[model samples]
Target: MNKIISALCFSIVALSVVAQNNPSINQADTARQQRETDQVLREVGPGDSVPSLFSEEDADIGPQTVLRKKKPTWFRGTADAQIFYTDNMFFQDGNEQEAGLAVTTVEAALTTPPCITRFASYRAEVGYRHQFFNYFGSDDVLAVPGTILTRRFDAEDFDFDSSTAFAEIVAQTKHYQFRAGFDYTRLLGFEPLR
Candidate 1:
């Protein structure tokens, strides 16, 4: 009985050691997996013929092909007109006055299409805007002397116009985006207090 038990233990230990150090068994398994993968690939045909999600109708399916076309350059323009009443048209803090004003704004812009490089994509845009403000129903705004806002404008002169022009460039990468822009504004009929 002792001999049988010892022999059984020795065989088990030898089998474990041989299995742990066997390279041929591992190679045989890898070769079998590769053969199965090759067979599946052959049955499925080339990867280029597979259709991906949201793919364009004319796009070619391949590793190196682009799936979408670049956006085209465009031009846009907008105009808005509004009329409203305000309790304090001149922005006086302590003293308030009631007035109605008409406002108009116009904007136009042109944007270049995206330009893609090796590291990032870039776009450029240029725009201009013109805004006008004409005040009404404020006949008594200048009736009192030494008013806080009276020094900025002449009697009964509360019309204002402003023009702005801007240009900007944006660059975007996989994880970050950068933007640089400049704008210039010119104001008319608005002045600082004396």
Candidate 2:
């Protein structure tokens, strides 16, 4: 009698579990959830938009942002050499000395890409230049020193080389333009005059 009672209890519990997990019960809930999702998508429409903190007109108040698709920077250089004759080596009106000389000039620069915007355009550059003067027949002539008629010097005292370093910024607009720059030059062979 105890065995029969236990078998009956087990069968009742198994049937109750099967009824709770039936497919028909889940089908109705799935259909209701799918309908709600479709209704939400229809109400939102097909277009997409992003929310922004500021309006379009408010963005134009301060300095405008410069936009460049491609920034191109370049390194540039130039060299020049010339041989010339000068009748006045010292550039004196009373007594002019004649000489033959060669001049060589070299320049190099590095420039940043131009920054352009709706209101203005600007660029920055740094450069260096060197010039050398060689006097061939200058030694044959005599140079008069400053304020001393008795003192005479060789023409080689005027032969000198110079080096210059510079930096510049250029800016332009529709109605106005501006430029700012500075250059420093050093003479290599002018100590005798000092």
Candidate 3:
């Protein structure tokens, strides 16, 4: 019985070794693997240079170069005029001197562009004003010789007129401002008072 078992085991080992060493079976497997690789290459096609799948097309994208214009830096000027009047100009001490007053004023201003300097700007202005007063009441009361008795004078002595002109310059910075100006004034109709 031991000899029969040993013979059967030796036969099985020899069959397995013969099957592993067969050249025909190995050739058939190599042929099948080569065919499969050829079929996969055919399906994938040639590999020419191609655009990226995630990138935008040239026709669908907007223009890459654009032109823009700069803005103007200058500003316009300003002008103003005003007039005022009063029927009874003098009411002090309940005098009711029956005087008429009229005043007229005019002004103009201009501003310069920042093209002058980096931190400062400038502006200029000029102004003119006129005043006229008509007096119907007496200017003086002549008193009797140290007695307090008096006589009234004519209204022409009390009438008055005046005119004034002024010019100004302004300089401005980020945190501070400065201004300088001059005025010229003329008076008429009251030489004794002046």
Candidate 4:
């Protein structure tokens, strides 16, 4: 149960990280595409450069979504890593007589894109962990029927994945551009607040 929860939390963190990592890449792609396509027109009419400031819909505030140009695309990359140490090898949870085992971790990551319009990316990472636990620790705090007591624990460690997949889409007009996409996340898990 803890592992499952941990995984879910890790995924949430990773998602947020990816979202923040890329801001105008999509917009840049859209803007570049627009500049390329709009260049064909020699004359720039007032209407061309400036579309309707407000929605043209007869209804008031009707879907006030406006379009705008995007910036030029530039190459993007990242490098991340971590290191860890622990006394528990299994990292199980149960009873804790002492302060529990201690652990440290170190990890890293690196990713790159294939093209601007084409949403493609890959990442890699690796880390180490070590810990020490005792019998009172929950990792071995099992309740045996006959013995009516728990067992002592030993070593433990942490687990982390070092890979990711990402995608993005960009749309634009004269004044605004919108972007949406998904990407792989790592140990940085997610948990929505109530």
The deviation in Å at residue 119 for candidate 2 is 4.8
Candidate 2 per-residue C-alpha lDDT over 1-194 given as tens digits, one digit per residue, 9 for 90 to 100: 99999999999999999999999989987777665654454344234322222467345563333233233757878999999898998788866888888888999999887777657789888999999887767555655545556455566556789999989998988569889999999988834335
- Once fitted onto the true fold, the runs of candidate 4 whose alpha carbons sit more than 4 angstroms away are 1-74, 81-156, 170-178, 184-194
Residue pairs whose backbone atoms clash in candidate 2: none
Error of 2 at 20 (Å): 93
Clashes of each: 0, 0, 0, 42
Model 1 is weakest, by summed lDDT over 10 consecutive residues, at 45-54
Model with the higher lDDT, candidate 3 or 4: 3
For model 2 the TM-score comes to: 0.49
Evaluated with lDDT, which candidate comes out highest? 1
**Backbone clash total, candidate 1:** 0
Q: How much lDDT does each candidate structure score?
A: 0.75, 0.74, 0.55, 0.42
* lDDT of model number 1: 0.75
Better of 1 and 4 by TM-score: 1
| Residue range with the least summed lDDT across 10 consecutive positions in model 3 | 45-54
Q: Candidate 3: misplaced stretches above 4 Å?
A: 1-88, 97-100, 106-116, 125-160, 173-177, 190-194
Q: Relative to the unseen true structure, what is the C-alpha lDDT of residue 63 in candidate 3, on a scale of 0 to 100?
A: 26
C-alpha positional error of residue 6 in candidate 1 after TM-score superposition, expressed in Å: 46
Model 3's lDDT to the true fold? 0.55
Model 1 spans with C-alpha error above 4 angstroms: 1-71, 116-121, 143-156, 172-178, 190-194
